[model samples]
Target chain A: MRYPVAPPTLADVAERAGVSRQTVSNAINNPDLLRADTLARVQEAIEELGYSPNRAARNLRTRSSHLIGLKFQPAQEGTANAAMDRFVHSLVETAGGAGYHILLFAVGEDEDHLRGYDDLLRATAVDAFIVTDTYLGNPQAAWLRQRRAPFVSFGRPWDDDAADHPWVDVDGAAGVDLATTHLLDRGHQRIAWIGWHKDSRIGEDRRSGWTRAMHGRNLSTTGLASRTEDTVSSGHDAAAVLLDEAQPSAFVCASDTLAMGVLHTLRDRGLTPGHDVSVIGFDDSQVAQVINPGLTSVRQPLEEVAVEIVRALEGLLSTPAVVSPGVLLTPTLAVRETG
Target chain B: MRYPVAPPTLADVAERAGVSRQTVSNAINNPDLLRADTLARVQEAIEELGYSPNRAARNLRTRSSHLIGLKFQPAQEGTANAAMDRFVHSLVETAGGAGYHILLFAVGEDEDHLRGYDDLLRATAVDAFIVTDTYLGNPQAAWLRQRRAPFVSFGRPWDDDAADHPWVDVDGAAGVDLATTHLLDRGHQRIAWIGWHKDSRIGEDRRSGWTRAMHGRNLSTTGLASRTEDTVSSGHDAAAVLLDEAQPSAFVCASDTLAMGVLHTLRDRGLTPGHDVSVIGFDDSQVAQVINPGLTSVRQPLEEVAVEIVRALEGLLSTPAVVSPGVLLTPTLAVRETG
Candidate 1:
């Protein structure tokens, strides 16, 4: 990929602008240090010759990469979750304005959970990390904390009350509650909840919203909830059992994937959704938006979450390195045709 | 993000192992240089102390960040294309084995197209770029070529006949042909096509496959094709028009988003998709797999594409930097309930 012609350098810009190399550097880095006229001349030379200062040299001088490492794992197969993509897009866009780029590395399931972080830390490849897998039992946040690594979590430290690391997370319980309240307002008395297994704190948090909403209305919650793995087939079978035995008037799912399974069951039974039985899903994923008749869902304020994460990162990287308090943003309901 | 405690360093590891710092460095960089027992001792000490070599210092010495920059643009709103996410996942996993990480920078629609590339290039932030937006008339490829920057495109140079660059692209034409022929085998002679505007070379390439398949089977192409934007609503509206006027037995769409629109139309009209009229979409997106009575579509060899791209990058970054020829992998039909 090498080209015979070398890239234009700081010296070339200096010579073209009739300024010293330091003056050219100042024009690029600290334009306020140069007079407007001289800066304009240097800028013109830069534009004409397309000169870019060497980042390697800059890293040696500043000891910072302005890169944030994110360990990316593919969504589990057979699930209808695309929430990570949306969050990542928002992160990249939000971080770009702050002059930060995301460095993505992949770790296989069998690989050590902290291997990616360890390698990046060893190599100093990124200034800090944005740990996303903060599920109840995930060890990344604790590992990063123990290493004294500068970082922020996209999830609250579910199991670690002592963890004071900066974090920004969406309020799952609030979002699910909003979804459940929407169903209640629609006159659905028997509402069933479908959620992940007992191990997932996030899932339990979401499930609480349904139980709270039901209990708040003096309604019975027995036999109206099911806990299972997060998969479409699992949701389908669970919904089938709930519909047959519990005879719930509506269903609230932990994810859009589960909601899709409920919809599939409705279709199989020749029952019309919204008209026959209402359904709401979490994540407001693409499937919810595009599915036939449209699915009402809880939409995470992912863009706002991205903004807050960047704000926390800026505070973390500041001169005094202020450790900001954790933030939990509320999610809104996307009321589509289903609910 | 500053911690009260300091991170474990090489010197700490050396002290813990009772070895000189040089021996520790050798163990980390070139383990063969140390005796077997001595290497094991240094490794143990490093593991116990969680010592990671400074990547910033090593980068200054090596002049390479080992990062591949990828300019990311969010999918067009309301499109059923999650192809980017899948490709990114594959690229991250594939590149990890090669000791490379992906650096993602977001470029907004209003920003200068090459601004992200220019900034990263000036900073020397990555070793090379992996350009994905190679649709005809896009300027990124040409701009990178003029700057003498090293890059491998995920698309072939559709507009430039004289251009030579390492690229790995899935054959959209063949994928569509396979889908069309599958419909033909199912006894559908009047197969209509839903595609993007004429300006998109990739869309046109896909359209050609349907036309070629029809022509090869001695079928008429007249009044059975429609060109519109790559949106669900557009596809829905186009399918309505084509179904009413042309009365085709089946439909072939350029993207899953478009295919979804056709399905929406089918549902609205109470027409069973496969039983009444067959449909096939491209990209075999998540929407295709999970939707009721799954939508059969074309699935790209994205994982293979990533592997081939890494191979090209290895060639490009070698000592003498060999420029490998472009690669075009054939896609397969993911047959499901739709067709």
Candidate 2:
């Protein structure tokens, strides 16, 4: 027997099964719509022909694309926050295993961030969205909610406390607390906190952890807090000022990027890290791992977060959709040479 | 004066335009199939109703998805190579401007690399693919070719010299030459080369640059070349062995990851990176940028590569499709503190 030059199509399977094209389509897309005997014949024919249904047609028949829309932002040039790399990897793997793919679109710096989401929604291009930007007062979650769009955010709705959206977020305060307490347990007081500006809700949350830990021990955090942009240079400058003014023996930074800056400041001053002072960073980034002295950092449970996000998506897309409350996971410290 | 709770559908547009649902579908998916006046009437109704055509229906009508499928691999842990972050960002932006989005899928370690491609093709989930894996003897390109799939790769087809496929790649040899020559110009004779093992086609190509540059100056590279895995620890070990055995005054690494290792080894041996021993690395990664004193390395024009790939795709998808030959872009040296 000669091999067919072209792969078998749905019509080929229908003809082999002695059924109409609609019967084969229903058998693949909505088996419940077909009788058991007809479905069995179609299945055998499909297997014999090695037929794979067209996704577009299947999407129309099922009213689902099994594609999740995600807006991919440009890489921040100087920041060492590679959290998205690991998170995206995990999300893709988790979603793929669940028969879903991530459809990524780019938005311009000048364009409104919601424009991409609106366009995708208008075209019905994806079944749902995986929103990553849940920053303070960010309108994406609320906007999607207003349009009754199904979504799962990687962060909590910081601006709207009453917003009941499906979300999965790492507990930043808990993570920073773990770091600060670790340093305190190592006999360090005057633990300085280096974080983002006060306007940043996430930064404030992380800073509160350090303050709470310090206050619990009756240590004044009056001049040990420095807030600035989340960058290596800012981190470096903050650490320098804190060292000169407050002379803190330990530092708990908001991110690994900031931690790298603290490391730089220590190196410049000829002070040995973890000896003269201790440093702990958040987000166990690749930089934290491969730096000269391994960085002690708060590693977010990103893999678990991805699994949770996919779980939420599945629940949202089910026939009787279930909208679960936000999931908040705690991060663990990855101790190394620094702390 | 009142707002409609539900969005407009195809049937609504057809009714407003006094046409059948098929006419409105044809107007959106294949305007060429409709009479000019009838198409204009349907367009007016659609604009008035603010109707966004369903992507699935459009796909079925046009036999296209306006999507490019890309397999996103898990991020390599412990490696400083963040090229994908930059490349993916660029590809998404470039493709988005051209009215196409990226559909990302994940593959299991034990599964064939082509399984994802085959599944996507069989399902007609994407219009084409952007292949990134062009490693030596990799079966992906050959398998895709055998299936007569439309694709553009990010690396040259190294295993098959006669293979003609649209690809955009950085000139690895040229990048290494630039790095080597910079060191040579700085009065470095014994320039050791630290690169990946011989099995990697890209690594071998990069090593050739060092060999060619050394031979061009009539300098013996007999004991100065060392090969290992592309990792910081491997680079450290190679640098240590080279310093003890050959005592090279300068070093050129295949990647920033390896170059970082050399810096660690130098620090361990009481040698300043740029002062006592010159060093250069490829892929001017974020690590190279933020590392102390900065790292002098080669920067691939990944944005340009993305643009070229999109250009090739546009040409391939145009009416009566045009296929272009491989495009090779040259990389430039990012002069910083190291070399």
Candidate 3:
């Protein structure tokens, strides 16, 4: 693919600076080892010739890809999780600024997720991976640990028992605590909680906060909980079931998606949301603002989450000897209309 | 980082098969030059030892990457275009199946997009780029042409000019025509058009279809059009303004997002959407099925569009001589409850 005129290479830069090729490499990769004057001369020559190091050649030389792989399961229709989208944007921007590129691979429904991870690693397409979803017996994490591959999870392990790898996650319990406290402060005595029905550790963490808050306030938690999938329609159905059992003055939801369903159900029943049943949601995603009354939800610190995840991965790549500690960022409540 | 026991390389394979290293390389890269028995023997040997060719090594040797870069400008919160998300998924899937990886870079709001393109090209980080969005005076396209870099766009060039590169796009005019005819067949007499209020070639193409169909039917186009940004709130505002001037029995929208706004407005005004004012939208994304009344929309053939774009890029790379022709795929109308 070379044109009539080839690009200036390390050798060309070295020749222009009247130095050896190793000098140019050090000036670029390990500048501290070189003297100030020598580094400046090499840097000037490199810039004057627009000498960009070929990533492929560098990968071959160092046996490391300046690429990070992020296997994303795109958000679905009902929730349209804009928060995840923003998180990804932040990850890309932060990684790129540090001279790394993100290789995006779509995880298909009926595909072998672990095999994809293995292929990307074996092919040297990525140096490290950022895994966002960690479920019970996640094969991707298992395989990565087996291969001693460099990888970090964006969420905590399914249980603390497997917190053997690097991870960064938003504190779900703290997030719900903020929302629950806000609702309690508004004088809503009978506050219920809505969450995903699946046995997710993240969901349970969020529920624990409500349980703790309610218990500490000498309030009963009986007949005040409903579980459904994190979707608007599911939330609506959960609300119907909850309302049939008891009358709660407020509801704390697991996601903005579920909150939307509750909002729809309330609107359909000709009930004013904040007055009849104040509701709050977690993951103050973009959908929170779009809906009428602007759902009062807990805002995940996505920028910090992404930045710390990248920093964790960087630490993992640089060390490769010790396990990095997990980072837990507290989510804050973004109060608007509903609650 | 080769392990203690290195897997069989070409030299090892050649030694075992009593052939030259050149023969092994040909067997892997271009097996047509090898005899049937020799090719089968090499393939069997490769599988027996699980010898996967290292991609980074091959990239340095051939000066080509099995990587295609796509700089995506994520859809905004107002519209949060799910259609584009589906398109991206399709692109990643098709590209992955063909042994190509997608390097995703989030195109920042203030960053120079052309500079990103130029950097990726100069760094040899990608073999080619897939340009999905093209507008007037698109600097990215111009720079690629000037640099003789390989690229294929997913949309047609702006202003019908700058058709110097390969592209594959769905026929917008035909898409709206299908929707208009579907509505007309259902006996809708007064159908109005709503689309993004920008000088976009794609928007104009869709509007022309509605205009042509109405003119051909001897219907007056007066007071039957309104424009807004591609968002639900914008759609709602547009409807509020248009209702003061004329009351159309049906609204043909440019996107599913706009259809949502119309539905919301109808719901707020205590009017049943499908019964009071029929609505149709374009880009039958996931949101179409999730809403109260499903939206009848024109679905862009995303899978075909992605596949064709990849094929066009492949053609461009292999030939590297002529501009590959733009492939225009026809979009189909998905009939749902709204219309």
Candidate 4:
């Protein structure tokens, strides 16, 4: 009787190489482990029969692709500010240390990019995901939870229902409190807040913190000033409006970028930063150092937040369904000549 | 006699949802194609049966992962300048437009870090790889070639043996030629070159271009000056040495970051840039504008190069391997007050 022949497998190569199947697998995966002679024999056999180890077959036994996905929602195209650039750098360093590679996907213009999220999950392209630049009532987080896909958010979630999801967020409220309290302590009563969109969670949190601090000092929050956009031009325009309508002793900005704009506006109007009016900002970005008077701002621990996000993902992977949902990192006040 | 039962499959879900088996599969993989009612019914059935679609079974039939890897190698940690940041932004935009995602990986300092490359290959985490910051005699390239993995490099390789590999690189040599020729046209007889280590392919290419340009104009190529590190501090130190030893009418630097250092040194000596001496730099980074005399430099087409690299990878996947191995992109010289 004639019998059909089957292709050679790792077992056949292992027997031929005088090694165990696990050793052969390891030799293929991590060649540095085995002796040179053993590796050579296995390689020779693999070449002789044109045998390619099927990666899909192995991945079936192990339900991981050893890959993680990072979703970035930028404020605008062709514009990566210093804060976002540093965050991306930190993500790469922190994720690489955890033995997981990162896949970057951008949500451009389309606010409802949950279809991309579904494609990644259904295709099993990654073991977990990291989402950043979150907005109010983000649908992406809801979709991930519905599918039971593991993910971590870099910003605070707007919806209270999604608060149980894993996230590593900078303390925006505390940062605002630090800036506001500092101005109040310096005997500045009529303080103005600049650079924020009212709908944003971060903007709301920061405004609340400022209002609480002001109310604690027997001041009213109704007349507090704020701006819509955080650009340098916006800061100049906002400064114009503030100076024309209400003369505040100090101005608190949402970002250093905006503070730089305010500083320029102040300079054009013959006003010094620390002498004429005290100015404070957030993020303490590169603009802080380059701008004159050296901005006094809040410093967010970007590296620590990155590390915590990686740890959160690892925790989700190890326990499957058990994970602490949130981590709030503290922000420090960086005092300079501005305040 | 009792009959044995088989596991529930897509057909079972289709029957329960009153849809075709293909429709059920489509609802699982591509939900956009199915009606909301049909997708909801199919998904409910899938959840009730506690069934998970076998990814191995699907990938075996398809032979596609829909993922690509992008390897980013910075010169060192904390050295991601504006050019690098722009490169990453463009890479993401171009890759995402082609319906492919980028899996980003960085090379660490460990000698055994090459294992990360092997793991990426063995696990099939990506369909093709895009390598950046390639140096001479890189082990990563050799291993990828040995494994028949499809890849493209961002810079020229060290060894001519691997000349057949695909690469998309900025023409540093052409940039140097442009700078040198610009200075020569400005009637500068004695010109100095400030660059990085000679061992680097980029540094060597720039140096060769400078030498050839000088020789073309019948100028002396002796006393060619360079520094080991191309940073601001290094540029400052190198400029001091050049000023003391052989003072040239013009100075060509490797990068704007380094040019800032040179400018600082010249300023401290009470020498103006545009009037006393002319300076040209590569990479029109942010510092170029912040400096007193705006730097005349070669502005590399970072976004265009990134777009081309993604297009090359996509072409490699779609067509047969008949295309050329490498592509060189030209840089444009931005004329400013310094030059």
Using DockQ as the measure, the top candidate is 1
lDDT of 3 by residue, B159-238 (tens): 55646778888998898888887778878878888887668777888998888877878888789898777877888888
Q: What is the DockQ of candidate 3?
A: 0.25
Q: Best to worst by TM-score, what's the order?
A: 1, 2, 3, 4
Off by over 4 Å in 3: A1-53, A160-162, A319-323, B1-54, B160-162, B285-287, B319-323, B334-337
- Give model 4's DockQ, 2 decimals: 0.21
Cα error, candidate 2, residue B329 (Å): 0.8
Docking class of 2: acceptable
How far off is residue B301 in model 2, in Å? 0.8
Using Cα atoms, each model's DockQ against the true complex is 0.51, 0.38, 0.25, 0.21
Model 1: residues with Cα > 4 Å off, grouped in runs: A1-49, B1-48
Query: How far is each candidate from the true structure, as Cα RMSD in Å?
Result: 3.7, 5.0, 6.7, 7.6
Question: Worst 10-residue stretch by lDDT in candidate 4 chain B?
Answer: B1-10
Number of the top-ranking candidate, with TM-score as the measure:
1
Error of 1 at A339 (Å): 1.0
Model with the higher DockQ, candidate 1 or 4: 1
